[model samples]
Target chain A: MPAVIPTDSVGLVHPQTVDFPEPLTLECGRSLPGYTLAYETYGTLNAARSNAILVCHALSGDHHAAGYHSVDDRKPGWWETMIGPGKPIDSNRFFIVCSNFIGSCRGSTGPASIDPATGEPWGLNFPMVTVRDWVRTQAALADRLGIAQWAAVVGGSLGGMQVLEWAMLYPERLRHAVVIAAAPRLTAQNIAFNEVCRQAIMTDPDFHEGRYYAHGTKPRRGLALARMIGHITYLSDDAMRAKFGRDTRNGKAFSFGFDVDFEVESYLRYQGSRFVEQFDANSYLYITKALDYFDPAAAYGGDLAAAFAPIRASVLVISFSTDWRFSPERSREIVQALYRAGREVAYAEIEAAHGHDSFLLPVPQYLAVMSAYLERIAQESGR
Target chain B: MPAVIPTDSVGLVHPQTVDFPEPLTLECGRSLPGYTLAYETYGTLNAARSNAILVCHALSGDHHAAGYHSVDDRKPGWWETMIGPGKPIDSNRFFIVCSNFIGSCRGSTGPASIDPATGEPWGLNFPMVTVRDWVRTQAALADRLGIAQWAAVVGGSLGGMQVLEWAMLYPERLRHAVVIAAAPRLTAQNIAFNEVCRQAIMTDPDFHEGRYYAHGTKPRRGLALARMIGHITYLSDDAMRAKFGRDTRNGKAFSFGFDVDFEVESYLRYQGSRFVEQFDANSYLYITKALDYFDPAAAYGGDLAAAFAPIRASVLVISFSTDWRFSPERSREIVQALYRAGREVAYAEIEAAHGHDSFLLPVPQYLAVMSAYLERIAQESGR
Candidate 1:
């Protein structure tokens, strides 16, 4: 790809890792001794180090939240449309720190990371990590970066879960919490989908019980199938209809065999194949597990309102109308709980057809809401 | 499992196969030399032979549409709740012919059927079947049964597609069409989900290119995964939340590994495993292919209203409130199209939480609607 970075783009950026020698305790009652978090910084931290915004990523997202990794890179980071110099996130006005979650394969401590004791990839040996655990690691990264508090903690989808965790676990670390297209917990249907995806990965012979790293051959088909399942959930029915419909590949009539007939099938197959190229199957297992275990309200007698006791950060919950995966109702659940807890919370249901993935897209009204909300944060509570 | 049949049950039944010796041409430009269709009958044909109702089965469904297989049978047929002496379908009032579709794994001519020429299972060699093709076969079966035309053709989900096809392709063959929770055509999202499930089966190493019988072992994992995926789509979010919720299996704590943690996951896993025991992987491929090819409107210049030109049967369409798989809006498409064609059509949106499976259940309102509609069909058009 040519150097076509837009004027408002975050432009060229580099990733960095912050190491922590201290053991990190996990919600699963396990600990990782001396781990590292890979992250990328955009713009600059203010003199007081309070202007930093913690940008968390969804499942399978990495440290590169925005900007071109290199001139030859085909696509900029995911959410690039939402995070740029003059965009809703406005990299120019706020220092942004986007980090790979601890259980991610993106140069972070995860299943694919090497164990210090055995000098081998942790594989299945890696401790289970939760949203709270990820939030704790992000907090450590903030401390290492000398930022006592963030201007705002922002994310969407699973990333949005982290934003909530920050408010629940380390509420004083951020002034604004932007939880976009997230649910406070996984529903039975949600867990069922996750379980099915995991089964797709685990059932593959090449999966080798998540120790495929030793075998040198990963379960590509399983991982691909898992991604395909996830992809369908990410896009709304309207989005798929608009993009593919019943159109066939090359306008070909039904081949009458077990080959691709509809364009949607071909599209899903292509996306599934592409996913295995960059994602680790073992890490997918860990990520989904974390998602299933994200109900903080469970500890409060299943009362979300009661679980918001630790929140000090002002919350902004945004939902897309067509996001059936994490529907607008889920956002309202968070809003209702926050309100019941007497915490400051704002909610806006954006009308978008992209479904759960709308959070990463540049929907006009969505962008406007974010810009207005962040601007108010910058002006009224300047760091 | 003793003879515990209910008072109103159809009681023990036997499946019968009708053999056809003529070539069956498919829309895919292929033909089956000869075929056999397994079916079960409940209620005797009247003297005028006009009380016959052809009951279509959905994807993965079989000929046993109602009644107990034997006195030792543990459960009745899939739709036992709705079809009996005093049930909505009222086996006593209607001569019900529930036959396995041409491309299904039941006692029918499908991929797993033995080829007379080769003395082996057809497997991948089986000609692709469509909804119209299935309807044609049903017509042939009706000719064999000495029923000139059915009183009503009834089905739901993929089965419901057959009812519409009966109306469209063989407009004069039936007097009434009762389509429940069926879409006029599959949306892009619908096709995408089907594709993923197909991929799950096709990609399994044990699939052996749809000739898994040659391997003496089937792609159990792939078939199981596909069923797991399908099971999730069968129910609505609210349905699942009400049934399983986030409850863990046996109320156990999360094991923090790639194992079943939630009750929903456990239920899906069991459903998948059980499915693999009864279903043929190759048959699954053909069934989903049929579902994807069921867009009659595509031939009518993508106008469903135009597609209704061939549907002469009086139609009674029903939809459940939470059937997101084939939403109530889809049923409206059929109703609107029938209206445009100046055809008699009745529409009912049953307020039930069972989702797509609601059609098979004995919801009081849904049963009342079915009973009332069929009563009208019987009395007004008596032979």
Candidate 2:
């Protein structure tokens, strides 16, 4: 384990890459061969390399977990609150690694990746990916980094799915696991939301059976519509009311014509339009399917507890109060399974109204709980 | 008034049509010059023509309020519960009439209707219409039917808007009015929902900017997406949970791909697809804008009480307990204004889980209340 202290002048670190191979061949019977994984690492790796903390991201998140780049100009990573100096997953105490998932379009091999054989964008021909496949890829990356084990693996929502997978697949490799605002499998409603988005994208005339790029057309409108629908679920009714209750966009009177009307409309439109610039619609299709197919307990003969039987990691499971898409009830299910599996665990349902995105919000209680947990683990690890 | 107890063969017959041309001309500017109104009557028209009743329809609703078409299998009018032989708006006594509003894709003149001079579809050339314009057209139809005044004018939601418009524009035309689950004007949220739908239609590449008829392409995807968005609002969260939960369509396991994962997805897809078959995208744009622009009170100097100043009608307003879109508070606002205007009125907020569409659903209390109110009015009129 590394000494739990920070150095004043490490300056900025650059993101690096590692090679990983697909775990199991696709149902289509073809192995994906070797693939490149993009990741960013902060802090230092100890001689023992046991103080590593893996960070998983949500559906649209990237590997930039914290800090800013002079060139990129993007905001300091999505989870800067709990990942920086003296923070919850303090860089001074652990080597933090955040990797873009394989099925993601963010510099990863996804539906938009080039096909080795066809010599063109994979498009719809990309092989289906499951959560297990994603975890396996991460494991390969850990191996290349000489990280035989990790102090903890933490993630929220879809990221939490990866954390659960880590506990199930390589229990001996991690000392603690944190899963937040996630489910054991795709719920019917979750599936419904994904399906509607897919239908919206696939049915767009511009989609052209996913050969949109060949025809020099983009399913931007369809993708935008999908984002709008998904954005609604990402928020709670109360949040929406507080954010934009009956607030007109342009004027008070109705235009009696086709135009943006409410502030919320303008907000959603901006979200959808802006998203299309950096996102690939094909990647959305593939990744959404990966989430829909996730079932950590299915491989364990229907016993979720049995699935975590091998894990030796103490677990910290967190959920948000207002995440309708992945509610607290879902988090409780994971906690119950971990308990039944006899794993050492801590559970907390944070009081936050930010829906599934609460984990990223600046909630004081969340930080206090995480800081205490990380410090306690570092003391036990003994650098 | 005609004898209340005596009517021989044809239940009630007072169908009439009149010319309507006032205010501003349509976008086509071919002054409506001489408008031809079409309407059907129910009960016998009293000698004084004061026993006539008016029924308004929602966005896609038509004038067929009851009974099956002699030669068609499309079923009875959308609202058959309160408009039949012994029902609330009893055809046995009150002469009821329902007419499709202008800008509707139905038999009424709309974007799909041919221009008188150009002999081509009005298409984008149809002048934008306000809720007030539709009401004016309906009032003209009432005059042609020899109806100097109505026993009552009744409607729900958008239909309710028409009822309020009637009270404002032609107070002497009705002795009483019933408004159900409606607002005085479009709130910011209401306008937002409408704007998204309009954008969905206009952005569709197949829409061809409202001239796709010659291209053999229809903006079906946009229309479907619009309907899907609308469907979400029409339903309550509790209703969605009770009806769809997380149940997948015909499977216990996710297909691990971009297929319908939940029952809700199938339901929404079915709704959206079905809507496209029956509705014109342009008409959707026009009608939704009408609803969004409605503000009878605002047009009357921001005082709802003043708006009802000319209304001689005794009013009855009803609201469903679960209607979030046009909540009971909105109905209360209308009732308060009528009361402030010194108008005779009855108000009821019925308990139902069906939300804003509850008026269109089966509810014993709603029907019972209507029956009691009508009988009381009939006795007072001595038709």
A1-383 in candidate 1: lDDT tens per residue? 34577888888888998888888878899899879899999988877776788899999899998888788888888988888887888887889999998999888889998889899889888999999999988988888889898999999999999999899888788999999999999999899989999999988999888889889999999999999999999999999999998899999988998888888888888999999999999899999999999999999889999999789999999999999999999999999999999999999999999999899888999999999998887775453
Relative to the unseen true structure, what is the C-alpha lDDT of residue B236 in candidate 1, on a scale of 0 to 100?
86
Q: Which ten residues in a row have the lowest lDDT in candidate 1 chain A?
A: A374-383
User: What lDDT tens digits, residue by residue, belong to model 2 across residues A180-202?
Assistant: 88888766557666776787789
At residue A64, give the lDDT of candidate 2: 81
Q: Which lDDT tens digits does candidate 2 get at residues B1-383?
A: 23341232222333344445444464323455334444566667888776788889887677766554443334456776677677788887888888877777766777877767688777777778767777877776776677777788889989999998888788777777889888887665565557667777888888887877767888898898888877776765556767886566885566555657668888999999999998888889888877866766765668989887888878899999878778788899988998999988899999987778788876899988888988877876676
Docking class of 2: acceptable
> Model 2 chain B — which ten-residue stretch has the worst lDDT?
B1-10
Error of 2 at A381 (Å): 5.2
Taking chain A of model 2 alone, its TM-score versus the true chain A equals 0.93
Which candidate should be chosen as best, given lDDT against the real structure?
A: 1
True contacts kept of 2: 0.35
